[model samples]
Target: MAEQLLDVIVRKRELQGDGVVVLDLTRADGAALPLFDAGAHVDIHIAPGLVRQYSLCSDPADASVYRLGVLKDPASRGGSAGVHAHLLEGRQVQISAPRNLFPLAEGATRSILLGGGIGITPMIAMAYALEQRGDAFELHYCGRSRNHSAFLAELGSAPFASKVVTHFDDEHGRLDLAAVLGQGRARVHMYTCGPAGFMDWVIDGARQQGYAEDHIHKEYFQAEVDASGEGFEVVAARSGKTVQVAEGQSILQALTAVGIDIPISCEQGVCGSCLCDVLEGEPDHRDVYLTDDEKAGNDQILVCCSRAKSKKLVLDI
Candidate 1:
C-alpha cells in the first residue's frame, strides 16, 4: 500500500504504566484525523532515519485524536527509545496515514482478542470497535503485572468491561494456553498480537484446539527474518551497483551498506513496505504479505527477508 505522509503534533503525553507512555497526536493544522478501523496502526517518523509502526489504541469513532502507546524497549535499535525519550507534548512528528494489517474479521459471530505485554494496544482498539457493533467478543490481555500494564483504567472502564480478562506475570503467572483456549472452535475467530514468543504460543494453542488457520489472525511488531538463505549477489540494475549478501544479512542490508537506501518497515516482511521489483532472477520468497500469485510470478520480492533463489539477482531498485 502507498503511504501518505501526515504532519502531526504530539498534543499530550502521559506515562501509562511502567516504561510505557501514551501519546495523543493530532493533525498539525488542527483538523479531523482520517477515519480508521480497529487494529489500525501508523508509522511514526521518530528520527532522521527511524520510523516505527505503532498500533492506534484510541476509539476508532474519535477522529479528533490518535492515541498510541509506546513501551521503552531497552533492546531497541532506535525506534522505541527515540519515541520514548524525544516525542513529548508539543513535539512535531511526521506520521503515515493509518494502515491496518490486523483488521477485525468481517461477519464473525464472536471474537477472541489475545494480547501480551505491549501487544495490548491493538486489543484495546478492537474492544472499542466490537462493543460499538454490539458484538460478543472477549479480550484476554496478559502483561507483566498490573503495574506494568498500560491502559488498565481505559480497558476496564470500556463499555464491554465484563468481557475483559487480565493475566499478570507477577501475580497470576503465565497465561495457561490450553485452559484459556480449550474451547476454541473453527466458527470463533481469533486475533493475536505481541512478542514473537507470545504470539507463537497463542497461535499454536488455538490450532491445537481445532481452530482453522484462517480463523486465527496474527500481527507481529518485530520478526526475526529467516537468514537461512545461501549467500548471493544482488545487482542494482539502475544504479549499476552489485553487493554480496552474506548468509546472515538480507538483500536489503547488503544494498543499504553500499549507501543505496530502500524504504523499509516491518523488516519482518509483513507490511510489504520493502517490496522491490525483480528484474531478472528467481527469489525464495519468505514473506507472509505476498499473495500466492504474486509469489509464483516472481516479479516482485520483499528484499527485507526474501533472498534470490538463483546465484545472482538483477533488481529494479
Candidate 2:
C-alpha cells in the first residue's frame, strides 16, 4: 500500500455524550484537501499500530476540514478507546483520502432514515444531502437514552426536524417496528445503519410490508453470521494459484496474505467491493451484499470475509 505523511491538525473536539468524541481535523500544509460527498469515511492512522475508520460528519461543501465522531466502545478491540484517550487538540495524525460506499441514490421520491446509536454517523450525512436537494424524508433515531445519543442538537436543527423522531429505550421503550414500517406512504426509499440485529429487524419488517428489495438500503455496523465452520482451499483462476485458508480467517484476508490485490471497503461484507467470480464449487454464502438468486447462480462471492463451503473452491480472481 502506498502511504503518505500528511499532518491533520486537530482543530477542535467536542464530547457528544455516551463516550463519543467528535474531532474536527484540518490540514496544516495549507493546501486544499480533496472533496468528499456525504456519507464518505476516511481511514485514520491513529498511531503506528492502529488504523480506524470514521465517517465524515461535516458538510461536503466545506473543504476546509473533516469531522469524525468516535465512540469509546468499552468492548472494543482498543481502536475506539485509543481515539478518545490519545487523540487530542493540536495533535497531528495521518489520514487517508476520503472514500464513500454509502452514497445517496438519485431519483428517489422520498427517504426514510433509520439510525441506531453510532450508526447515525453516516445516515446523518445522507439526510443532509437529501435535504439539500429538497427531497422529503423522515429520520428515526433510536438509542438507549438521550445521554447516549450523539448529535441531538444538530439533528434537531435540520430542516426536517419535525419529521425526525427520537426513540429512547429508557423512556419511549423499544422502537415500534410495525409503526415505522406502516407509516410508509408514497414511493419511499429507506436507508439504515446500525447493529446487525437492528438492521435485520428493519429489513425483515420492510420485507413483510411488501417493500421491494431495491427500495430498502442498509449499511451494517457489524457482521452477521448465520453460519460458521472450518475453512478450505480457494483457487484464483486468473492468478492460477491456490491458497489454504484456516479456520478463524476470512477468504479475503487469506488471499491478500498471498499477495493478491483486491479492492475492498467495509471489510464487514456489507459493501460489494470485494465481490469476485465463483467459477466452481459450492460457496457458503454469508455476505449481505448478494441476493438469494445471485448466490444460487454461483456467480460471485465476497472474498473479504466470506469462506468456502466445499472442501475446495475455484474463483475468477
Candidate 3:
C-alpha cells in the first residue's frame, strides 16, 4: 500500500534524563493508528524541512498513541535539533505508518538484548514483548552515565528488572564484555542496537566467545558514508530515466528529486523500507539492513543509503 502521511498531534513530552526528549503523539484526526510490533519504527515528518525515523518505545497494543524519543544531537544534520527546538506539547507533526525490520523470530529458546546510548529505544519495546510472552531473556544497557540514558525509570521498574543490567562507562569503566557474553549459555539468540563502536565491540566479543554469526543480530542507529571521491548514475528501467547521483546525493534522493515516489523509512539504511530489486548493475551495498547473502544474490538494494558500483545501473523500481 502507498504510504499515507498523517497529521499527528503531540499529546505530551517528557525529558528522559540526558539530552533525550520523549514525544507522545496521537492522530490529529482521532483515527485509529496502525498496530505495530516490537522493534517497529515510524518515519516522522517533524517539519517541512526535516524527517527522521524513531523506534517506537511504547507498548504496541497502545494504538491510540505513538511514542518516540529524540536525542538532541549537537552534531546532528538538523533533524534532532529541529525536533527539540521546535516541537512541543499540542504541536502537530506528520508520521508514516509503523515499519519493522528487526522483528523477533518465533520459537526461540532464550533471548539476550544489548543496548547502548539511545539505541535502547527498540530494545525497550522488545523487552515488553518478551515479558508479555513470559519468555526467558536478559537485557544489558550501557551508556556514558545514567543521566545520559533514556527510559531509565521505566526500565528499572520493568518486570524484567532483575535481568536488566545497566553499565555506566563513566563510573564503572568499560562494559564487562567478556563476562556478559561469556555466560556460557547455549541456544541463546542475541540482539543488539547501539553506536557503531559499541556494536562492533559486542559483535566481536560475542564471536570471540564462540557465538555463531547467525545467533547474533544488530541494528545500527547511524550510517556514515564516505562520499569523498566521485559520483555515479542510476537508470530506472520502467521510467526510462537516468539521474546523475553526485557523491553527496543518494540514489533515493536523486530519484525523489525527479518525482519518483519510493518507500523509505530510516534514510540511514537501518530500515528495509527502501529496498528495491536490481534488474542489472553492481551495487555498492553500503546498507546494514540486508544480509550478506541477500546482497550477494542481487535480490534487493537499499536505495536510501546504497549507491551503485557500476557506472550505469538499472533498477526495477
Candidate 4:
C-alpha cells in the first residue's frame, strides 16, 4: 500500500548546532497529528522525485507537533542541502505518517541508548518515553564536540538529565565501546544509532561481549550499497512483461522504465518500501533493511538496491 501523506506547516525552524537544524512541524489545519512511538521516522517529500527520512525527536506525550533534527550533509544528493536551503518558517510541506523500524524491546529490565552526531534525534524521543514510564534507562550521546551536537542544552536541562552522559571526542578522546557494553547483558537491551563506523563498533563490541542479537537494536539513516551488477532479466508475473536489468541500473529503475510503478522511497533501500516477493530466483541482497535470516530465505527482495544473482528472476509484482 502507498504511504499516507499529510499536509503540515513548519511551525518553527531553529538552528541547533554547527550544521544541524531543528524543525517543528504541525498540521496545517491545527489538528492533532498522528501519534508516533519512540525511534519512529517520517518521510519528507522535499520536491518532486526527491524524498528523505528524518527521525522524530520530540516527546511522544506531546501531540502538538513533531520534531526532526536534520544535518546538512555535505555529501547529500540534494536532499539535506535542499531542506536547509528551501524549507522555511510557515512553509507548508508534505510528510508521510510515522513508521518505526526500531523500537524498544518489551519486558527488558534495563535499556541503554547510544547516539552519535545527528543520530541523537531518536534517542531523545526514547528518553522521554522511558522517563515517563519510570523505566530504568541510560542515554549516552557522543559527538565531535558540544558545539556540533544538537539538543545539548535541552538535554542537559531535561528532567532525565541525571541519566544522560555525553562524550565529546575533542575532549574525552573517544568513547570506550568496550567499557559501555562491559556491563552484564542480563535482561538488558542496547540501542545505537550513528555514523557507520561508530555503529559498527557498538554492534561488534556488543557481540564480542556476548550480547544476544535480539537484544541489540539499530537503525541506519543511509547505507553503503553497490547496486550496479551483472545484467539480468526480470519477469513481471502479473504485468506479463519481461525487462532487462542493466549492469548500471537497479531493478526498481528497470521496472519503472517499463511503466511499472513500484512504491519507492529512500531509493537506497533502507526504508523497505520497495520490497517484493520472489517466486523463483536468488537475489543478490545489498540492502540493510532485511535481517540475515530473511536474506538467506531468498523468498523476498528489496528491489530498490538488491539485484538478481540468477540469469532470470520471476517477480510477483
Model 4: pairs clashing at backbone N, Cα or C within 3 Å: none
Per residue, candidate 3 scores C-alpha lDDT tens digits across 195-279 of 8888988998888888877788888878765444368888888888889999778898889999888976557777677889998
Model 2: clashing residue pairs?
Answer: none
- TM-score of model number 3: 0.88
After superposing candidate 3, which stretches have Cα over 4 Å from the reference? 5-7, 29-33, 183-186, 229-231, 243-249, 252-265
TM-score (C-alpha) between model 1 and the true structure: 0.90
lDDT of each: 0.89, 0.80, 0.83, 0.90
- The sequence of per-residue lDDT tens digits that candidate 1 reaches over residues 156-212 is 788888999999898889888777776766578999998889998899999888887
Q: In model 4, where do residues sit more than 4 Å from their true spots?
A: 1-3
For candidate 3, give the lDDT of residue 287: 83
Per-prediction TM-score: 0.90, 0.83, 0.88, 0.96
| Model 1 misplacement above 4 A | 1-3, 226-229, 238-241, 257-259, 279-282, 285-299
Q: Which candidate tops lDDT?
A: 4
State which candidate, 3 or 4, has the greater TM-score: 4
C-alpha lDDT of candidate 3 relative to the true structure:
0.83
User: How far out, in Å, is residue 70 in model 1?
Assistant: 0.8
lDDT of 2 at 239: 96
